[model samples]
Structure formats: C-alpha cells, structure tokens
Target: MRIAVTGGTGFVGQALVSALLARGDEVWIISRKTAQDRTGQERLHYATWQQLEQNPALLEGTDCIVNLAGESINQRWSAKAKARILNSRTDAAARIAKLVGALRQKPATVVNASGISIYGTSDTKTFDESSPAHINDFLGSVVEQWEESARTIPAERLVLVRVSLVLGNRGGAFPLMSLPYRLFGGGRVGSGRQWMPWIHIEDMTRVLLFCIDNRDIAGPVNACAPQPVTTDQFGRAIGKAMRRPHWFPVPAFLLRTLLGEMSSLLLQGQRVLPAKLQQGGFDFRYPTIESAMENLVGKSSKPSV
Candidate 1:
C-alpha cells in the first residue's frame, strides 16, 4: 500500500510511518519543513503541504491518506496558539479533501485524527463513538471542526479516530509525565480524580492499521485502552514505575496560575472507552495501566513504591 501522511514527522506520525514501512508499504510524508531522506531510507519521501496542494498528481496512486496535522494542545491556550490549533487541522483536512475530490484515482480510505477531548470533562459517563460531542469548550470546538472538515472527503471509507492520551516509549504524553517522577517531584494533580483515558502508542498505531485494513470499521472510533485510570492513579503508576513515592498533590489553583486554560486538560478529563475498537475484536497489547507501565519502564528490579 502507498500511504500519504500529514504531520508524519510528529510523534504519532513517526511511529505510524515506521509501522507502515515495516509492512513494506511506501510512505510519503507531508510537512512544512523539509526532511533529509529519513535516515537515508529511499522509500520515505517528504513534501510541503503547499506542494501537495499544487501538485494534485501526488494523489494519483496513493492508496490511503492519514491526516494527523495539528498544533500541540498542551501549551497555554493563547489566542494565537488556539488559532494555530484550529487552522492547522481544518486547513490540512480541507487540503486533503480537495485533493481527494480532484484525484483521478482517489484513495480507498482516509483516516483523520480526532481526540477524546472532544468529549469534554466527564465524571461518570464513559463516552464512545455514538456519544454526543461536547463542543462548548475550545478543545471540543477545535475537534468538532476538525472532524467536520474531514467529513467533506468523499472516500469509500472515512475513519475519524478520536484518540486518547497516547502512552509511548519515545514521545506523546508519557515522557512529560515521567519527568517529575524521574526527578522525584512526582505527585497527583489537583484532586487526582479526573479520568485519564489513554492507549499505548503501539496499540494506537496497530488500531489505525486495523481500521485501514477492515472495511467494515468506519466513522468515529475511540482509540483508547479499555482501562481508564484517574489522574491520581496515573501519577501513582508513573511514580511506582520510577520507584519513587507518590505523595503531595499539586493544587488546582496553582496549576491554573501556571498553565492557565491548559490546566483544564490536567484538572478535568473524560472516562472514554474504545467501544468501536473493542466491539471489532481488536485485542489490546497493554490493557491495564499497571501492565502498560511495566512494559514502558521495563522490568523494575525493585518493588513499586
């Protein structure tokens, strides 16, 4: 299969590209900046998003297109950052959809990345693909527009993966969380009761491939692990993995003072379930938080603190 990936240089995109290459697929990466041959691999190619838009011929033989372009939402939601977050996604989606529409031989599938933040801050309810979107907040509104932009692509299979917090060895949310633990400043956030829906990066990439291969799976799918851990539990798991004591809680006010609106992501969360993925018989490689943390940190010689 020949696949074109936007944001292919990003954390998730890099993993996805490697997974595709391992399967002997030709991968083309769309990015704003130019890359140098990707460790000198011939199969990997890079092009600016502008070049892709101008040269619609690039989509002629593309098998699938995965759009993962977006600004990091973890930073302070300054007005400029918020606009970049929204435009980066919607603009890329629109570009892809336009290319797909104009393609002489359109790709069979399009997988656009969404986020569980689209569900907003939920206490008890577990959201699935069928759950109504909470578009009132900034993150929710951005995702809502992101998905809406992708829907314009008239592909045979349009998959919108509402991804949760991605836990991985290299990047995404894990390392940042592990930092405090590594320095022995680890602790829970706020009341530590907010549910943090997450999936191992391995699982996330596999699920994307699964969606591409399985024709029956379409529409919105929750790309999250079955087990949903609270912020406190997550903090404890990380601390334990690093053999550090999980004491002291960061007050919500302090977080708000520091991170501002971005603090909401830490202070509030959703209990999201990968309803569609589970129903599709996709088995998780790391189902439980404990098991996932163990794999991430490797076998700890000492007992967890």
Candidate 2:
C-alpha cells in the first residue's frame, strides 16, 4: 500500500513511517521543508502539501492518507500563537479535503489525528466515539475544528484518532512531562486528582496501522490505554520507574504564572480509555504504566533518587 503522511517528520510520524516500511509499504511524507536523506531509501518520498495539491498526480495511486500536521500546543498561548495553532490544523485539514476532492481516484481511507483534549478536563468518565465533545476551552475548540475539517474529505473510511499523551524516549509529551521527575523535582500539579490518559508510543503507532488496515473502524476512536491514572498516580509511577522521590507539589498558581493558559494542560486532564480499540480486539504492547515506563527507561537503569 502507498501511504501519504503529512507531518511525517514529526516524532510520531517518524516512528509510524518506520513501522509502515517494516511491513513493506511505500511511504510518502508531506512537509513544508524538504526531508533529509537520512534513510537513503527510495521507498520514502517527500513533497510539500501545496505542491501535491497543485499536482494531483502526487496523490494518485495513494492507498491511504494520514493528516498529522499541526503546530505544537505546549507553548504559552499568546493571541498569535493561539491563531497559529488553530489555523495550522484547520488549514491543513482543508487542504487535504481539497486534494481528496480533486483526486481522480480518492484514497480508500483517511486517518486524521485528533486529541483526547477534545473532552477537556473531566473526571473518570470513559469517553468513546459516541461521546459528545466538550468545547469549553481552547484545546477542545482546536480539536473540534481540526476534526471537523477532516470530515469534509469524502472517503470510504474516515478515522479521527483522539490520541492521548504518547510516551516515548525521543519526543512528544513524554520528555517534557518526565523531565522534572528525572531531575528529582517531580510532583503532582494542582490538586493531583485529574486523570491522565496515556499510551505507549509503540501502541499508538500500532493503533494507527490497525485503523489503516481495518476498514470497519471509523469516526472518533480514543487512542489511549485501558488504564487511566490520576495525575498523582502518574507522577508516582514515573518516579518509581526513574527511582526518584515524588515529594513536591507544584501549586496551580505557580504553574499558571509560569505557563500562562498553557498550564491547564498540566493542571487538568481527562481519564481517556481506548474502549473502541479494546472492543475491536486490539492488544496493547504495554497496557500498564509500570511496563510502559520500564520499556521507555530500560530495566537496567536505576530510577532517579
């Protein structure tokens, strides 16, 4: 199969590309800048989405398309940064919709990235594809709009993965989230009652592939683990994995002062569970926090003290 991935240079994208290649699929990456020739492999190709839109041949014979393009949401949300966050996702989704509309042969499926943040900060309620979106904050609004844009694309199967916090060694949310813990400066943010939905990076990549291969799955699927931990529990788990002492507690006001509105990402969380994936018979590689963290940090290394 030929898969075209937008934002294929990102952390998740890089891993996904490697996974697809291992399974013998041709991968094409769409990025604003030219992709570096690190692999020196012809199976992987790169081009800009604008160029691809101008020339439909770029998408021709493409079996599937994954739209993962978007700006990072971790920074302080200044007015300009907020607009960039919204526009980057919506605009990219719109572009993909247009490309699909113009394609002489539409792809069989389109898997676009959404987020569990669409549910906003909530209690332990488990949300599935049928759950109504919570549009109370900027992150929720961004995800709502992002998914709406992808809905415009007419395809046989449209999948919106409301992904949880992905834990990996290199990038995405893990490095930043675990940094304080590694430094033995970890603690629960705010009340520590908020639920944290997380998935191992490997599981996330596999779930994407599962969605691509399975035609029956569509709509908003929770790309998270079965077990959702509270913020306090998450801190302790990381500390346990790193051999660090989870003692301190960061006050909400301090976090708010430091991160501005972006502090909500840390202060509040959702207990997202992969109900659809489990129901669909997908087995996770690392279902528990302990195993997941061990895989990430390695077994031989001592936990930070």
Error of 1 at 97 (Å): 0.8
TM-score of each: 0.95, 0.96
Error of 1 at 179 (Å): 1.4
Give the poorly placed runs of model 2, Cα more than 4 Å off.
301-305
Which window of ten consecutive residues has the lowest lDDT sum in model 2? 296-305
* Reference-based TM-score, model 1: 0.95
- The models' CA-based lDDT, in order, is 0.86, 0.87
What does candidate 1's lDDT look like per residue over 1-305, in tens digits? 99999988888998899899889998899888767783777788888867777887976899899999999887789999999999999998998888898899999999999888888787787888888988658889999999999999989999999998898867777778878877878898999989999998888889989988888899999999999999999988877766787987789999999999988888889999888898999999889888878778746523221
